[model samples]
Target: MLGRRAFLKLFGGSLFGLMALGGYAFGYEPVIRLDVTRYALTPPGWTPGLKLRIVALADFHACEPWMSAERIGSICAHANGLGGDIIVLLGDYTSGTDLITGKVGHRAWAEQLATLRAPLGVHAIVGNHDWWHDAAAQRSGRGPTFSHRALSGVGIEVYSNRSVRLEKDGHGFWLAGIEDQLALRRSIRWKRPFTQGLEDIGGTLAQITDDAPVILLAHEPDVFPAVPSRVSLTLSGHTHGGQVRIFGWSPYSPSRYGDRYVYGHIVEEDRHIIVSGGLGCSIMPVRFGVPPEIVVIDVG
Candidate 1:
């Protein structure tokens, strides 16, 4: 019913818009940005006049169309250049969907992470995806999860509901990590063979000195609420900063507690939690509004 010229004009404009959006999602947003957000924490045991830098990278989700092995290597190489005192990885190493297996890629990625130089140490913990995939693998006789093998192979200690000390000049604080939130609950729900002492936060804290300031690594931010006041700081990444934020806020964050602690630094009374926007996408390869990031927190 319209003239040919007008119809062609409208069609051209729509095509251009779709192309631009595709470029943003597949090309620019994922590859161009690797934000290094900084935060200052005032933990009770933080050394007066002494500063410590901790670098946290979460939700690598290594696979094709999102994060490749080379991309993961480059990310770690960049983090190494930052010269952080401690490097902590907050899990979700592989994608949940089967678009990419990520087995070989993960191994290569771990090798690159091994080269990281941190004064204190490098530590990591499992996320829900890791547990989920691992569970699936076990059923098929694929043996234990690649996470334990790859991460530990590089000397990056992986902790599950346990605490360890990071010493510098004989002065230090306690760092603890818990298993994936859903995995812990799933074990109870299915009444399957449960791992003893899994996610026993109280038991983990018991190992540390009463006065020692604790830094907890919990992959999912939902665990933030249960973390005690004794835990001075907690590092987490699971919501992916909502992945697709609108109006500087997201309505679809994957959390039981909603977007309260979706991303960046959050202070609850005396406790502090820093959730990274994360370095990779989940479910879909597209990321809008929220880009990949590596968070750096300095405490003193």
Candidate 2:
């Protein structure tokens, strides 16, 4: 029903638009865009008169051309200027996908991350990819994974089912980190396939001796449901904003909850969770509406 010239013009425009989107997703966003997303909240039961600024970096799937050591160093430098009281590293330091042209070694990325600074300290927790990529840890079916050793070697305290109390301005609170929830690949048992997790939420929470408000650092947002209201806030990475979110909805998410826990700040039943879009690519080197990000949170 259309003239030849009109139809050709419409087709050409659509094709060009597709090409531009592909280029942006594959080349520009993943390689060059680094966003700093900030959130401010007063969690329930938070100590009065205590204000804390948290700078968090996550999912540095370090690999050549995508996330180089120099780039990570630059990110750390930027984070240092943010005047955060504490810095937290949410996991996936290893390359998460085989699409990399060259793999960045653990030490290279770890050394760059060591440059991160905060008045309180820099704490870390490993991700699923960190465990999956560590052959020795996978073989033994236990941790200290290679990622853990590298982060520790760089003077970063990697928390595994651990809780530590931190104070600021004479106000005290507990920071708890649980181990990866998908650390091991298990064989199918009785016609069902399930991965084994190293996370011990109960054990970690038990370490908190006082009634101080707790802030939990979990690598994957999928654990949010099990988190009790005792935890004031839960910070997480690993969904990577579904890796290609559009219109605040991710078409594909690795989380079992799909778009429910795919990205950003979420609150349910008076509990709060902030999931970082993260700083690297996983599964593939492509990004759309959800660009790589450094997340900052201000809590009172």
Candidate 3:
């Protein structure tokens, strides 16, 4: 029904728009947007005077043209300057060795991340990508991955199906983490469906009793419902805020629960989950609408 000139004009316009979008995604969006989202957490407890500031960083792919060492260092600097009481790292430190740029390695990334400091402490958990590359070693009784050791070397405790009590000024809260979802499966071969890892929420919870308030560090938000209501908050970062969003929706969310837990804060009853957009990209190094973020949760 359209004339020849009209078709040509429309095609040309569409082409131009696509190119512009690609350029923005590949160039500007990845670097320019570093958002610091602040969330107020008023959990079930009635401690009106209690306040805690937690800075969460996740999914620093740590490779390629996007996440160079300099950029990672800069991100850590910003995190340190944020004045958080505690800094928590959600995983995905590296995509692939092949994707890494010059003068960057797992050790370097770990060292840079080590610079992140807070009065309370720095804590971390591994992601699916971390297990993907080293599942065999991690499963073959090779102890923790080298990356895990690197994190621990810098005083950042990597909690794998474990729990620890964090105390400040006589107020204490339970901080726990489970193994990444992929690590718990029989095998995490590439191209296979991601089954739930052997996350021991009960065992981790058993480490603490008397309900002093709980915050869980899970690499994926899929573990959200598995967490008991005794937990006040859960922090996850594997979704990358859907990587890209259209009118606040991302077409490709790497979550079994779909976009329901894709990004930001999701509150169900008294429990809460904060999914960070994360610091880097996966698959394709492009982000649109949903920029990388460092989430700040203020609990009182």
Model 1 error, position 125 (Å): 0.8
- Model 3, 225-276: lDDT tens digits are 8788888889999888999999999998988789999998898877888899
| Alpha-carbon deviation at 10 in model 1, angstroms | 4.8
Q: After TM-score superposition, what is the CA distance of residue 39 in candidate 2 from its true location, in Å?
A: 0.7
**Rank list by TM-score:** 2, 3, 1
Winner on lDDT between 2 and 3 is 2
- Candidate number of the best lDDT: 2
Evaluate residue 204 in candidate 3 and report its C-alpha lDDT on the 0 to 100 scale: 86
Candidate lDDT scores, in order, read 0.79, 0.92, 0.82
RMSD of 2: 1.9
Per residue, candidate 2 scores C-alpha lDDT tens digits across 122-144 of 99999999998877787778899
Clashing pairs in 1: none
Please report the TM-score between candidate 1 and the true structure. 0.87
* CA deviation > 4 Å runs, candidate 2: 187-193
Among these predictions, the greatest TM-score belongs to: 2
Q: Is candidate 1 or candidate 3 better by TM-score?
A: 3
Question: Which stretches in model 1 have alpha-carbon errors above 4 Å?
Answer: 1-11, 100-105, 136-144, 184-197
